[model samples]
Target: MPTLSDHEILTELDDRMQMFIRRQEMMFVATGEPHDGHDCTFVTGGPGFVRILGVNRLAWPEFDDVSLSDAIADIRRDPRISLLFVDFARGAIGLHVDGKAKVLDDDAMRRAYRALNLDPSLDLVADRRPMRWITVYVEEAFLSAAGELV
Candidate 1:
């Protein structure tokens, strides 16, 4: 049977949800390896960094170009990810996005975003651009009052 909490879970992000996500400058991403282990870290890219590919899709660039980051490696191997977008501006509920992810280069990532009728505005830096981008196809999303940004 479906419970009230289950009913509160949103399959697609609403306008308000989109706005909140866009306003966030940083978000925590979690990924795991195929065999074992988990990786979670914070990523930032100014406001509107996490692009909304669709109601159930999101993408962000991986800016650490020098090293093979654990999160990146896990995503490549497992593809499962969980993104937490918290509200630093207020003590509000955090938005959770659980999904499968893929890594793409600049051109490919842009194409994918365009295919969804989205504008990959790529305002990351003026001189250099990110070589890799991680796109998530969200499977589930919900808001949690537990990790409120106080």
Candidate 2:
């Protein structure tokens, strides 16, 4: 296993992030918890946007304050996170991202969100609330394909 660098993150996300976000059809997000100290993982894709930056950070556009707060609070306690992309039609890929996560509510990020077409949508067309983005700070990342060691 090798540590993921900032430059490599930029390249990988720029090239392959979209495929995971789009082609995979679904993804699982795992977050850290301060209570039980166990990771909380959930499947999220429908009615949500996955935005990747570099290798470590990920953001979701158009999330409400309630959901955003929950995600941010967990990140504050545990920065480690992992995202899994499963391609039922083909092979599978698991992307492990070990870093910090932050919920950002900034105008610049909002603009970028719009530019990237990662805006919040209620029905994939209607503009939604908050328009926040979850920024993941990457410490390490590993990619494993099917039948390979993860």
Candidate 3:
């Protein structure tokens, strides 16, 4: 087993980080612009909402809600984004990923997810439906323990 040194930031998702991601149902996303500022939004889904495509890759769908349009727009312009995943149910174990993102339509997301049925959880999108996916190329990843952050 590999041990995480203090204050170390990983460029790829280690086994523990991957496990954490698989259990998380929600994440907070921060997208920024060069001059203006940043927008922080919450993304929610059912089981396995976030798919780990590779060691440094993650994929999550975006529904058709107009409220999310701005986040997509920011990604298009800057591609620099930060994501925070915290599991409060389990003493607030957390993961933070900083990456560049690209927007993909439904078809693209399906192909990337490698399944015809890209389930973004039913109830959340049952009526509105997903419009696109935010594929992130993680540049930095950090893990936070139960009581203290690392």
Top of the candidates by lDDT? 3
- What is candidate 1's lDDT per residue for 45-95, written digit by digit as tens? 778888887898888776554443888889888999999998855775688
* Per-candidate total of colliding backbone pairs: 0, 2, 0
Candidate 2 lowest-lDDT run of ten: 6-15
Q: After superposition, how far is residue 149 of candidate 2 from its true place, in Å?
A: 16
Deviation in angstroms for 94 in model 2?
Answer: 2.7
lDDT of 2: 0.54
Highest-TM-score candidate? 3
Ranking by lDDT: 3, 1, 2
The sequence of per-residue lDDT tens digits that candidate 2 reaches over residues 27-55 is 65677685755444454555235555544
Candidate 2, pairs of clashing residues? 9-54, 57-136
Residue 148 Cα positional deviation in candidate 1, in Å, after optimal superposition: 14
lDDT of each: 0.76, 0.54, 0.80
Clashing pairs for predicted structure model 3, backbone only? none
Which of 2 and 3 is the better model by TM-score? 3
lDDT of 1: 0.76
* Better candidate by lDDT, 1 or 3: 3
lDDT for position 18 in model 1: 83
* Candidates sorted by TM-score, best first: 3, 1, 2
Task: Please provide TM-scores, in order, for all candidate models, with all chains considered together.
Answer: 0.82, 0.62, 0.83
